[model samples]
Target: MHTPIEGFSKLTKAEKIDWLSENCTTDAEKTKQLLKRYWNANSSVQKIHDEFIENTVSNYYLPFAIAPNFLINNALYAIPMAIEESSVVAAASKAAKFWLDKGGFKTTVLGTEKVGQVHFMYTGNKKKLLQFFETIKASFFEDTKAITQNMKKRGGGIKDLELRDKTDKLANYYQLHCTFETLDAMGANFINSCLEQFSKTLQKEADVYFDFSADEKQLEVVMSILSNYVPNCIVKAEVSCKIKELDEDELSGQKFAEKMLQAIDIAKAETYRAVTHNKGIMNGIDAVVLATGNDFRAVEAGIHAYASKTGEYSSLTHAEIKDGVFRFWIEIPLALGTVGGLTSLHPLVKLSLEILQKPNAEELMQIVAVAGLAQNFAALRSLVTTGIQKGHMKMHLLNMLNQLGATEQEKQQLVAHFKDNAVTNASVKEALEKIQTH
Candidate 1:
């Protein structure tokens, strides 16, 4: 059995790798070789990657791709996506091209407010607590004045503060709910710094409040942090055209519009369908989010929370065909920043932002929204017409072949064969076996 080790982080990179390979692998030298093979050719670049995270392991890579012909708000853009999935970029590009002649995507930033909270417990009189909060609310801002100085200069700072009583739900539980406008930065650190200060002030003030009883004076700060549920930081992206113009090669315009609307209705009504439907939207959203070096996980959490905001889980993308026109759109909460965190530090992130024409926070929000809206449009179109697997499986073919250890000639032959044949695991295996036999 392997034993736990201490002071592992104190070891040098080479020593760490050596220890890990020996203790964790069946073939130590091969493990080292595989890890080293992924290192950047330039030592300086490799060193940068090493410092990106702890453990100092070799770099893990994902494909960086571009989807061209995106015309958003009367501007053309070639959006960059970094993802391991194969069909996402292709689908997004296809949708963008489809909408190019139909007035492309139009987007608007709905709001740019974010949220944070300070939770505490005080077994005090509710009315007295409320009065105390009204008196000290100004101090919350005053305490964090230095921290919010730069954000204020940028026209973004504390928006509001409220004292929420949750004593009925959890005894003596209360929250100092706050709202903020961070402008070009995600402002997580700034919001959190301000919240921590507010928490300290709340405890300190409660300790000496004249009206508080001895028990009420016992204010316990639970936690102070930024919330991932940002309903106010929202953006909307949409595409619309005459229903008669919805024509593709095989499907009639009216038929296509009707079928697309029906598919969306089913997705909105059924929970199972809605989950996958929203996931398809996120495929495009997350690709761009990851490429830009923003927190995709935070974006994902906030978006899904927004999806269920209406009491039931449902589709994020909505479709409607009326007045001889077909309209599809999505409005999602996205707290994105274009000027901070890894946006300036990561080389690829900087390049991705540059490719996006150096958009501000609101512009980036619109762009990301367009990506998601385009992706869902492509997915629904395929589902209502030729079906989804045809494109998805075709994109997946190369990965299947690579996994089988097929040579160049075999991959070429199999690629051609699968073009006319159905793609499935058993069929692929059989085709490869037959090719090898010959």
Candidate 2:
């Protein structure tokens, strides 16, 4: 993949499409088929009627432009995100530009290890099962090691094991929590396989029939299928930039920082506000996750659960100003993928990965972390400076213009007019009439 054009805004729609095609691999036929699937139209019929013909699916593909000018950890990156929401890309680009003008975004990613858990439940006496696990802990772990020999060789292995018991007068059950450090891989498939094998070994050793699947319907008590709670492997980064413009506005960096902190505080204090607050961060993360074909739903669930882990829903990121510079930081559970599964299936997902130059899973995670932080900054800046509606409503008006069937020139005039006057159906109708008369 090559660098984007210097002034992409100057190009026509066709030119932009052509430029993207040249810089990155494009399967026009596949894209058309996907769009057709989205439109719920037969590919054969649409091929004859529509300029862009393909199969119909349940979802439509809409492209938004991801602008450049980001300096992350002293490196320049052109982050291209695919999303349908308005202002996300533009807001991120603006935030990145702000950082670049000051200094740059300084970032540091921790390790490349992800945690996977295998849960086990015992149907036998809870005390007996607990004692059995304690007695054979070393042997069981050794067997686990044998299964994950390759991973151990790569400096990753079963890190720890713990037991939790729930007992009452009627019944008792114990849980075996096995934690593994999966290095640079999603590791769910591998971890599950290892757990299945270990479960058999435990059953054989104890001479007890362990009901791996406990039916909650029949028995008043049951065991967990598996807990998706990620291990405490934290990823952290900090971005600091000197805001000379804030000084010019008679706003000391300290005051600006206080304002930003207040906004963040407000976001954390209310679930209503925190929902949109986190959505901004997801705007950046989901795009990258979608492009890589990872399970965005799993990531979302883990992140939201993490956000409320403290018993109060709050923002995962924080911002402040110190010593005439703005500083922002975020730490979140961003379990994502760079390769395997749908990343290898769909053509466009593969193409987006190619444009990213095939970053390893760790690098992909780092970039995702940066995007989340940038998106957070965008949201706060808008809330503090010009209202968020200015940019959001502007993009929305363009979408309305598309629905009105205004020609390119008419669209330009209508956009300019709407900027000065409030937008209404009557205003749109008047513009349409003028276009027809002309």
Candidate 3:
């Protein structure tokens, strides 16, 4: 039976682990051993990982890899990727190579606006509140001067502030919608600080206003936070080649072009297909995001929201073959930072940025977008020709073999065997068992 302990966080890491193992595990010694196995042998490196978060356990690691031959906007780059998925790096590399001779990927930053909101409730006259907001709108920026000073000096700061009336949806509900430009940083902290200051200023101005009744002036501040749904913080990446040049030895150019268009259309029309389709794209986007130490979860949430912006979840990548040209592309909103958070702190993240030739935030957005576009192109190319499972399962075979405890020699043999044989769980398991028996 587990009981709550007071001040658990106050305990040392070893002490916390001791208490957790004793109460939470069947064998405390075994749990301790298991946790210690993953710890870095270097004490200084271990210490750095420990301070990254609270209640530190052993470090959890993912494979750090690079996909070379990426030519984005006439600049060649070897993009770094940090992910566990076996096929992602391989697929992105393949896409980059395929497009290398086809003019590579061209990218553009459409917008760089990020958003936040301050929510509050007021039961007073809506029209009066609107008028009051108009009169005090400038004060909102004026009040957050201290917070926005550095950001403003850096060519980024509060863009606009507006009061949104939502009484039709919820009684006495309103929002102070705000937008900002954080320059090269993700700006969550900056945006949030400005929003909190705005919330304070809003309530203060409303309270002291010489309005009608006391009820009209009473404003209840709910919450102030940054929004991850930054649709305006968008970038587009694309590749285009003449349809006649789409020739591969396996399939005719016309057939290949037609099949790809049809595939994308299915993804656009079907939710089931679209969900998986978009996930493939994210596998590429997330790898780069993770390698650069950006917020993948926030990026994921904002992207999925954008996918359903048309009232139905659909493909993020679009393909069109017209006017003798085949164009494939993706436009996604990625709120990324090149200067703050883990970008400068994490060693691998710094290395990853260096590997990318040190792109600023806007350029980083374009590169990430290109990674996703390339990945989708490779996936679609495979799906329309050799089929996804054949290549994906082939890439996944080593992972499965390791999971099943295959020896190195056995893995080598199975790798050769599966080159000609279909890779499935049953097939691999049977072959491994047979190899051992022989």
Query: What TM-score fits each model?
Result: 0.97, 0.76, 0.97
Q: Against the unseen true structure, what C-alpha lDDT does each candidate score?
A: 0.91, 0.67, 0.93
Total backbone collisions for each predicted model: 0, 9, 0
- Candidate 3 per-residue lDDT over residues 52-111, each given as its tens digit: 898896888899999999989999999999999979999999999998998999999999
Report residue 41 deviation for candidate 2 (angstroms).
15
Over the full model, what C-alpha lDDT does candidate 3 score relative to the true structure? 0.93
TM-score of 2: 0.76
In lDDT terms, which candidate is top?
3
Question: Cα deviation in Å at residue 223, candidate 2?
Answer: 6.9
lDDT of 1 by residue, 104-167 (tens): 9999999999999999987757788888889888888899999999989989999999999888
Where is model 2 poorest over a 10-residue stretch in terms of lDDT? 217-226
Question: What would the per-residue lDDT of candidate 2 be over residues 17-108, giving only the tens digit for each residue?
Answer: 55555566577555544444554256453333333323212245668355578776677777768788877888888878877866667655
Off by over 4 Å in 1: 210-217
